[model samples]
Target: MKSIVPCLWFSDDNCEAAVNYYVSIFPNSSIESMSYYPDEALDEHFIGKTNKVITAEFILNGQRLMALDGGPVFRFHEAVSFTIECEDQAEIDYYWEKLSHVPAAEQCGWVKDQFGLSWQIVPYNMGSLIQSDAQIQAMMAMKKIIITELENA
Candidate 1:
């Protein structure tokens, strides 16, 4: 088990499905374990949802993460986001294709997945590339970043 892991909140009781979806997208990923609500633990509010997933532990590209079916009390927003460093444009495109769902959320390589989780798909050397003033301007105008454009800038 990881010392620390990010837990995603799913209000729709789809934690297991969401974890499986993420595992499918990234390499070196798998479900470590899953825990469901027990029948005896089900209260009146959760009478028919006894077997629903309460928590699921999974790994994505070596990063340990957890998903929780915490009910409809909370949701995900842009305040927190996961960043993926891509080695090339292909890598960027691959992640962007899989994770991006909201068209309007695509800004400067940041995208929101179907589950409303925000992610930033950036080149591995993004920090060094952004050192140049021109590159910064080039990046500002793009949704999904193009490594070649940043390099040329």
Candidate 2:
């Protein structure tokens, strides 16, 4: 079977730092392999990044992911995001605390990290919890998912 590996594009030279941050946050996560840009590259875009990480493959909670320093021409946006399904409110808060960096972009359990990657920190039973309009409203008002509030709503 052809396996699909998700890739994250970090702006300019921050890919390695972002990969390290992610690995530190999750248990059982580590860098699988890394490759650097050619030291003698002719492209102006990669001039100072010769010693920087070109590609870094890593695992997050057993899920494999790849990241690269693809220059400032491209960036991570809300169009693509990683969703973390939390077992409880504590799990939700933990991931939220670790990933949330852009306060202005936060809404409805979704937040943008320092790397500008969007992440949805939500409850595992989100589908069941948002069945009612009240519950949905409660969730929509939250930056991080609150399980008990959703249940009470």
Candidate 3:
């Protein structure tokens, strides 16, 4: 087992939505398991409800992700977003197209999906060069490069 794991929180059926979307986005990713509520507790908030995916495990490009029907207490925002390491613009485009389903949420290589989850679709090498200079100009340059790369693709 890995020392730590990522537990994504969702409101109602959003968890299911994310799981399905992720499976479709990554070629090697698939749902490993999904445990729903038993029949006896069907009427409860989540008990016996198929919508409540107790535990859903999947992998995206060799990265394992665990999702749950964690209810509406927490929400997703740009403060926390998943960074996809892409070798080329095609990979970035693939993620961008899949993630940018909502046009209003699109911003500087960042997007908030219909489910409220934030994702940063970026080129892998861009981060290394950006880290070398945390200045505003360097950040802008990196963003420009990413946009240029995506445009060229």
Off by over 4 Å in 1: none
Alpha-carbon local distance difference test for all models: 0.91, 0.91, 0.68
- lDDT: the better of candidates 2 and 3: 2
Q: In lDDT terms, how accurate is model 1?
A: 0.91
Backbone collision tally, model 3: 1
**Candidate numbers sorted by TM-score from highest down:** 2, 1, 3
List CA RMSD, all candidates.
Answer: 1.8, 1.4, 4.1
* Segments of candidate 2 deviating more than 4 angstroms: 41-45
Could you say which candidate leads in TM-score?
2
- The list of candidate 3 runs beyond 4 A from truth reads 40-43, 47-51, 128-153
Worst 10 residues of 3 by lDDT: 143-152
TM-score against native, each model? 0.93, 0.94, 0.76
Cα lDDT of model 3 by residue, 1-153, tens digit: 545667787766567778988888878888878776556455565554654566788877677778877776777777888887777778877788777766676655677777888887777766444443343354453422364433333
Per-model tally of clashing residue pairs:
0, 0, 1
